[model samples]
Target: MFRATTATIHTLCMLALAGCQPSSDGRDHGQMQLDACVAEACTTLNLDGYGMRDYNAVAGLAHVTSLMVSYTDFADLSELAAMSQLRELHMGMTEVTDLDGLAAFPNLEVLHAQYLEPQSFAPVAGLARLRELAVGSAGLDDLSFVAQMPALHRLLVVNSVQGLDLSPLAGHPGLRALDLRASDGMDLRPLLTLPNLQEVALSRIGEDIDPTQAQVVAQLRARGVSVDLDAIVVPVC
Candidate 1:
């Protein structure tokens, strides 16, 4: 009776061990199903209504290039380091205050980060391949760091900064368009020295200038730089 009872216990242990064995067949089947689901979703991604909660769902996908996360409540994008192929990133109107996690995307070209602070652009200087950058309505007072970026082409700084001196953008041959409007105390004389400047928007210059502001405007026009005057209208009726 004792031997029979031992045999029954041993048989049960063997069955348990068999159940614990890793099955390649089951793993392969699960992997195939996961791959198919990912393939279907990538081709038909509806990125409009998705919020920060859905960010984890797409973080594993390595094939995505363009991404727009505007109006989301995401304050940090540390998860984006996994996406090596990301080219364009839009984080406009979000609660993000820091740009520390952006160094991983070496292939990033265009970046639109409007309505942020001055420290937000600290990580942008590391992107060597970045071409176009549009940052507006942010409390940016200094652009001296932008001189390090060799590949920058178009830059728009409008309606936020109190005083901006663009002397750092002197020797950049790749710069084409520069828009500086409604910046309270900005001096336009430094930008006229740019060798490759083509299009410039210097609207609302009279707000910060004194009585001799016309002479300064005349100097900018003489240097072959197009200046658009932004005049204020007073209602008399």
Candidate 2:
């Protein structure tokens, strides 16, 4: 009887071991498959127009680290919420109006949304780790939201905006680079107050800028700010 009991226990152990063995087919995990699909799409995608079909094809695979959907015809990008591991997201020339889902990406660092509207950036304020942001040619009328980004380093607000006061940007101590090209009729006084500012691109000056402001720009250049006046077409008389 003792021998029989020992044999039964040994047989059960062998069965358990067999069950634990890996499958010979070597199928990948669901998440890994998703990641691969996203990586492949990001590498080969073109940003010509709305890409709802393309995005829908790979929406199920959402483990991508970097996603670029530039110049696509996508109107609603809410499906991007699945990409939790996304680090860099570039959606230039898309019609996406809402970015509320961007907050889900905790590791998001760089975001480039050029040619978009100001309202499109409202959702990115919640991204805690955001570092670099470029929203050139987005027709932004307000920059109050930038003050909320504590980790922001580089900012580009060039072209397509009017009547914007950059005083709020003074709170951003980590900001290094700023681009305000083509912003005609804007005052440069508020921009001069940034404490850690290093690089500034001022293009398309309006009648508002005067010789005094030019002197201020010279002072900023003396203090290590690389100010570019190449875009200043007509001097303020």
Candidate 3:
């Protein structure tokens, strides 16, 4: 288990001074954005949309409540353990493996990974306060870790739906949003019984959902649960 030290303060300063450098917002900004990301004192760090080839700024961030690093190639998260105040962390395509760095943020409430095929949540199982989790890929066959998340309310499993088995979610009542990009035909009936699942968004279906499966999703929506039946790709098979 990692603990705070003087180094934590230095890292926090780095994050605060992130804007002292200068850079553009991705879509238009590149390393130039992060390079200019040095500030004096700030809490929320919005590094989203930057093609992050380096993350030296993490060391100087402390007391941060929300940090968005989504849509970048950031791999190293060793500096995260120091941001004890961190609550929301968004990462994408960074090709990360270990999550020990995240264990330090006991206050983490939301964790978003653009693609989960390359990451693991096993290390963060101790995050008792996690309320929302989003993964861009559903490549993993074992998501039992989800059940371990007692405070989880929103979950987004995007990209591939290969080998998905959501049976473990049978009794999950706290989840309010369930977003899936594709599911060969994973029976969503189990979700209907969830007491608090308020919204279900099935976006970007790779193959057409069979009629029976489509009806199952429809039923969940008809039962007063919100559903984003976005362009069902192809008609029901």
Candidate 4:
């Protein structure tokens, strides 16, 4: 459960936590045809499916604490800024590039995205209260931006980032769990410095360990770190 709301889950956001029909795969919504889809989904908590509708309703809920909108086309996200109480959001497979709109939700603690584009991460760089971030995508090499998140506790990346430099995670006091099996040949040395890190899972990766990495693993084990080397590893998600 989330600290912000007892109803919200830690890993699964509204779309996955609640029962809602997701948008059909391969549906392309251009500029004009997609606004209606966005409006209906955002206004009502249930995006059950995507279709053209006439209503442009806002999430008139009293708390406005959590929301999920997936498979909708949103070129401009100015509408989301009005949700001052928003604490968690799941942006599912969106074509929206204006992610800076998320900065408005200062109370936001958890974020789960079905897609991860390059500039999409920049907007949350200053959101210090962010705790959990889970995003999946094929192309993600520079995750250095994660260092900016002060309260980040869990980071689950279900995508490949070959030869990623995890050096940025050093000294992150709140980081406890890390799941990075999709990424290959990562440097584990940086993780050794994180004092609060409790669990680390790296599975299904080709054994390409060097002497330096083995030494780091040995040190971590000696320090009581939980390491899952072989398993279908994943974080809370």
What lDDT does model 4 reach? 0.61
Error of 3 at 73 (Å): 2.9
Candidate numbers, best TM-score first, in rank order:
3, 2, 4, 1
Residues 1-237 of candidate 1: C-alpha lDDT, one tens digit per residue:
000112244465455434433344443433443356487755222232124343565567776676665444546777667876778776655566778878878888877676555355778889888887766554776676578887788776644667666677877766767766544566665665667776666555235555444565677678775655542211000
Per-model TM-score, in order, reads 0.68, 0.70, 0.75, 0.70
Relative to the unseen true structure, what is the C-alpha lDDT of residue 48 in candidate 3, on a scale of 0 to 100? 60
Q: All candidates' lDDT scores?
A: 0.60, 0.61, 0.63, 0.61
Q: Give lDDT for model 1.
A: 0.60
lDDT (0-100) at residue 118 of candidate 2? 40
| Candidate 2 Cα misplacement greater than 4 A, ranges | 1-52, 118-120, 136-139, 205-209, 231-237
Candidate 4 local lDDT, 22-141, one digit each (tens): 344323322223444355444324332342232134333434466555554533456667776767776646665667777777887877664556355667666778888776566666
Each model's RMSD to truth, in Å? Answer: 22.8, 21.0, 11.4, 7.7
CA RMSD (A), model 4? 7.7
- Poorest 10 consecutive residues of model 4 by lDDT? 1-10
Separately for all candidates shown, the number of backbone clashes (residues 3 or more apart, or on different chains) is 0, 6, 25, 0
Residue 114 C-alpha lDDT in model 1: 62
- Model 1 quality (TM-score): 0.68
Model 1 misplaced regions, further than 4 Å: 1-50, 118-120, 205-224, 230-237
